[model samples]
Target chain A: MQTEEEFRDFILNGHLYYIPHVTIDCAIFGYHAQQLKLLLIKHRNIDNWSLPGGYIKRAEKLLDAANRNIKDRTGIDNLFLQQFKTFGDPDRIQFDKFDKKKWLEDTGLPSWEGNWLINQTISVGFYAITDFSKTRLQTDFITEACAWFDINNLPPLEYDHDEMVQEAMHTMRLHLYHYPIGLNMLPEKFTLSEIHALYETLLGKKLDVSNFPKKLLALRLLKKLDEKRSIGAHRSPHLYSFDKEMYALALKEGLVLS
Target chain B: MQTEEEFRDFILNGHLYYIPHVTIDCAIFGYHAQQLKLLLIKHRNIDNWSLPGGYIKRAEKLLDAANRNIKDRTGIDNLFLQQFKTFGDPDRIQFDKFDKKKWLEDTGLPSWEGNWLINQTISVGFYAITDFSKTRLQTDFITEACAWFDINNLPPLEYDHDEMVQEAMHTMRLHLYHYPIGLNMLPEKFTLSEIHALYETLLGKKLDVSNFPKKLLALRLLKKLDEKRSIGAHRSPHLYSFDKEMYALALKEGLVLS
Candidate 1:
């Protein structure tokens, strides 16, 4: 197996024997303030907001490229990055009749010879749910600003990124129905109501509070804490944390929380 | 959007372009007599067999390519062709230093000049569940024979196909937990016991028939027919067919029956 450093070197070497037209972009999703959020960057030239993305180096896997793009721009490497789907539409990168030759000319980047542009781009999208508090945002030379946007009110995204985000949301919707996803988006300990609130946010609707507790308890994926919230006007609710082992075991046994 | 013919022409054009180097391969899983079945095609040169697969035509979607491959080989299209996962290991095709360039050269097929060889091979894997009786299998010039082997006793497959099958199984396992999948693999209308038997064949173990009916019935994804099983040593059992509306709705809701 190639070491991480060796892999990075191999990818950045800029060899010509292989096609170098491919790029990997990540739709890093996070649940924050009771809304779905996506990390976006303002490019210097495009003048449009887009997902934090970059090219896949030669030595790295497509997933590795996504992780590298996330960490290189955000200083967070351990985020859960799972590949969702591939965007392989032939016209996916048709930025206004800009063919391969024109693309190279416009970018002023090194023109990779060989059917570099003819090699169709199969973009492997990844969804990363990260602890927003721990992220240290960093902007690359090509980018001007970086921030998170509420998914409900997204800015105009460049290229096929909007479509990518839509696909990710569809996948997330499916995930929320089967697995508790926003647990990482919450604090270390959270109230039952708060947990329910997160689910509501993800599902984009209300859930039956009466039967939810029984269902969750039956699943036994969470551990109730002794502490209770004291500040809110509503009644104090007990807090809970996910039991990783039990959750893993339950999923293995074909038990889904939702 | 380009016309289908135009798209086909673009893909067939001699100009080597940077289109995504993606291949669509199907696991083509079937269940028979409490045993998992995998459809395999014998390769041209070696003793090894492979899952029916094809390269993603430039104009063709990955899922379409997989379906087209299955149809070309088995004369079965318009079935459940689900896009399960996309594999993009940079060296996934590398076995015994047999890289893409070397393989292309060995094929002795017309080669095009471009970085297309170096382009990432993102394979979109789909699993098609079809009744073995309904299939009319055919072999291409590149293939020597086609057969369905018990998945439990699979022959060594070429490339990363074995891993691909495992991934498909994992996806199927998830589907089995919440949805009725073997409907396509079984006769038009099957007895409840036959359906349960099919599940046993898929899960590779016996299940509590009593509780199994409760879950299956509760899901309401199947419809009981007025007719009964035609042939059996014992008393004929009530037959059932998949409820199309309920199945579509359940699929949309991501509800697994198991």
Candidate 2:
């Protein structure tokens, strides 16, 4: 929302336009220079940091809602986004510490009872992958701050977001074994070791140098280029690149990279 | 609901007890004797068939809701279930073809506008695997008939259920490659061919029989018995049972049978 009036209207009658008790929260993992990061934001009314998310518009597709949430919070668009899981435990969101009195005061409401925003919600979790160095963070009226944090050293997240991150990481890692990623995260033409390091960083584990690349090669998802790139004396390695057609096919039909 | 009054209360005041705009739908696939089937239900208010599903209660976990939906529709409980995906397209459910006038006439309602039951809901899709020959069918108040249909020759499903089944099958098949299944679908002691045909049936394709069993055996999810089972005068094949501990661990940690 751009103005206080708009925000007030959204708070009072948002269910008219947005689906109440249903939301889309995203775990945006950013990678660049062998470093992994996550995008988090602080809400204007909340004391804790949370994942980037928003209510899905009544007419919007969930994927579109996810893309809009990513853009609204991160100033980034068109990152590869995937639905990881949906979280709907009754205790997933803890509201005991929320400043209900202050919220009612700010919204100019008489009581918190039966408020549209106070209803129990189940959030559909989606994970997005992007290169952090390629984008800038943007915040809206409801956002206090938006930035990327190192995935390894994240601050204590609010509500069920910590669990959401763990679930997202697990699904994303599992997806790496079947689907072809790194189309946007890596250079068009790269070496096997570059892609190897990409996998190690994304998977958060070291892979055997010789065996892992061969597995990827056996899937025929990559192409061997005759061109070579030299890093040192007598140490030129053959440049390789992802076969775009095969990569797309793998994304649909899936492959077993193990 | 067992009574019409209870069903009416559910229709009118269900939002108070159930989360609005969110639901759980299940694609229960049954496998037995080299045959694959999908459990589908014909709702009393609709002519077309749908997957077994219902609203998630405000105080209930999603998995519990899934289990309840399966039991309410299938008369079976505790089958292995997994959440595959959530469907949230605004057009997923088509009210255009619904018999709204008959619905209101039966409900004794003046109009259907602003009704809680008419809200656009996003369904969490889950797929369950079971042995079809072991369980009997049951029907709830809203359900007209429930039965297992051959997966390959299913009738035209209602709303977006055809898409739901397709997505469920895709995810389930992918899971079979990475996880161990067949705890309840197969006998405790079975030959390699039995499991091989089970996979072939669920996958809807003929696999290379010799090589596929080797891949499954390599996962160490199976235990070969010292004795063999004789089916013919001279042919005796070794029987194998699942390594329950490893199978359970694989369900949690996942395994790459591929």
Candidate 3:
């Protein structure tokens, strides 16, 4: 845990050496229990939530900054991540509504630090998919709470983050249609129906059950296991896992699903 | 036309109020003579060419900057432009080789403007499709020459611009797969073979000639016009034009072409 003074110095002096007027915000989407969720963090005293984000170091690659932010927030590494868009609207920071000076003063920080916080910032949006079961959320000094919220039922977000999340979801849905994206969110082994549920959750619509399986099987990207998923008083669906080599080939060739 | 001294003031003082350390580069892809070409400009006394680009104004939207740049270079307005990627590699500006000081000295610019030129800049890449026949290429004070080069054979470019052009081409190809993108580049009326040739030029591969027409017609986005295109010693082909309303619907539902 960092003291207030230490935190203030880190934000003011330490971050001054970084590339100014630019930031990276990540919409880390996770799937678990057939629900799509987004990881969000709230500042110590702020009521509104925001995406896990950080500034780009002066020498750091943009993608590396996104990867570092995800690892810092979730303690998870080697996740599936991609830069979806860059938001550079002049009013993106919404400084009119966000009183950076007052917030810095209330937090007992020097007035000079407010300059760094109030500047116009252009943010690159990155979307990451991780297995929800594997992530252990952690909060840093600036963040008081970090948790996952169901994508369909998100809390009020800060500074155009709601729009960012919607864009991320839209990009992911488009990606899912052409690529095998559920592999990162699904377990090592899962039933076909479970994968179908994941797609439905991301697409925000139910797919035809009979046609879905046939379309997926045609790609030949899934390997059937001897095991089966047994649910109480229901038919047991055969377990399956990604055929890694074939899946890679299918992704390259593109498995288009209507 | 701006004198060297006036241009120095514009770079050093006039642009100081705008956003620093960021720029927008547009790969204006135009189709003419059945070939896809990219618009490029060369600075006065500079041997190498680059995409028609400009720095972002502090109050300007990123998209607006791209639009402004396109209008300034081509004298074309309301273009079909979309930002495909943001190139933020720390060494993107390549100050080591670019030598802003030397360039300014050679161009008779003040050394102070070199300071602004040497600073790190992250560029947003936008790809625009336009009717080549409709454009009037205009060269500004900074640009000595402006013209289009076929995508297959581009001249040596400056500051990672070759990579930017490649990325733009890749993005446009992927976009062409899902959307009716040739509307802006093709003529008001074109033969089926001409449209097919346009796609082949963009995709860098020949698609099935027989099935291509059937697939495109099934979407009901193209209407057979009463006109026909004639070539000497060849059979005349019936001309077709896009059904605007149906084309928009197809774009929304996605006209997926393999």
Candidate 4:
């Protein structure tokens, strides 16, 4: 594809205008159907999948590169993004195992471009939270397909992306212990049960149904709205929306929801 | 110095056997005299001070590199260390401001070494916590002196190291809110006021004298020892030490010290 050629040209001479040996990989996480999911892409003509990622421009901030990768792939903007960790293992590219010549032939890219891709890279890992239903996913020339896979059932990923995902999950779980991350995943207004469900999905464990709501309420980060939601054959539970001021206070004061 | 030549050779030919374009900068924090301090080293003939740091070996783990940096500088091992952030600005080395030719002339290195020194580099930031009384600081061939400066008063630093220190302080403060970082800085047995003073120093503000002790007690991380420390004119306060089991539980369950 012409787009692939343009990208190859960008990559071959990217060091002239961008930071060489550095890239940003985003572990874009979404919550849906009581399961945590990750946005991943399969490279064109390659049997492996990888996290949505791209190189950083010479003058761009690291976080901006992550945002650009997410926007280009998912068409989502202003998502909750945080830099969790940086992966700098020297053999991260694994050029010994990768068939760069075959890739160059399959993609019709110059050998220099293949060599560039095989060079040492230090990837900054960012984890983003977005509503799954709201994103419009699109694959670029480099990718054959874009899809969401359950975090619990991820496919074989490329490079050290699997480790990146695991680190992101560990960081998210640690963050959730003291921060109100459920606000980023849940609807604007919902019952305590819904928020608890989101936590269970992210933590991948069963929480005590009776004590969870009380612990959340103690933080005073949610405001009980007058409206209620009626579930099938169950009591109508009161809806609650995040109290922005209280949430800010909790962030400053630090809260333990677990 | 012969050490300088050896280090220069290591830098010039390091890429063939080590990871290139990536380095580590450590913000080694020590607590003493009811104040927080940072370990800094003044580079020989450079006039400017910098964080004690070094490059990662090709076959070394990123964290291992950080540990090696700490050990090489302070002659301390097994300190509490964590990676906080990474600085990947393309202009990080500031070659335009640095006199590469003069450095080569002074250090008696070849032109290739000068070019390698002027190349762009991405630095991974690691913050380490240690007891001030324990470390035996030493200066290397690159540094004329190594000493601890109060966090409130730091000398003019090289590159973006000032920002790295600020970021590390911010991260350590945040870490202190939910974790028992005092364990690393405090003595084996200390009074409540000593621990409170440590928090006040790290947080850079005076805490409520009465409420701080109660808040720490609620976490149950510290056990009241059978001994007591008598003040000059005040009542003797009970001595306390970290309860290993409860400390582990607090780490897992998440404790909010604030």
Which is the leading candidate under lDDT? 2
Model 2 chain A: worst 10 consecutive residues (lDDT sum): A103-112
Q: For candidate 3, write residues A157-217 as lDDT tens digits.
A: 9998988998887677767767788777778899888888888988888899888877777
- CA error at residue A127 for candidate 1, angstroms: 0.9
Query: Chain A only: TM-score of every candidate?
Result: 0.81, 0.94, 0.89, 0.91
**Judged by lDDT against the true structure, how good is candidate 1?**
0.69
Model 4 C-alpha lDDT per residue in residues B85-118, reported as the tens digit of each score:
8987766667678776676667565555435555
Query: What's the lDDT for residue B67 in model 4?
Result: 88
Q: What's the lDDT for residue B121 in model 1?
A: 66
Candidate 3 lDDT over residue span B13-79, tens digit each: 7546677778889999888767778899999777899998777778898988888877876676777
- TM-score per candidate: 0.80, 0.94, 0.89, 0.82
Residue A103, model 1, lDDT: 46
Comparing 2 with 3 on TM-score, the higher-scoring candidate is 2
Candidate 2: docking tier: medium
lDDT of 1 by residue, A157-199 (tens): 8778898998777676666555656557778888787778787
- Stretches off by above 4 angstroms in model 1 are A1-21, A45-48, A95-119, A177-183, A226-236, A247-254, B1-20, B32-34, B72-75, B97-120, B177-183, B203-220, B226-236, B249-253, B256-258
Q: Which scores higher on DockQ, 3 or 4?
A: 3
All candidates: DockQ: 0.36, 0.79, 0.52, 0.37
> How far out, in Å, is residue B15 in model 2?
2.1
lDDT of 2 by residue, A125-238 (tens): 999889899998988767779989999999999889999999999889888888998888889999898899888999999999999989988889989999999899999999
Candidate 1 residue-wise lDDT at A210: 71
TM-score winner among the candidates?
2
Q: Candidate 3 chain B TM?
A: 0.88
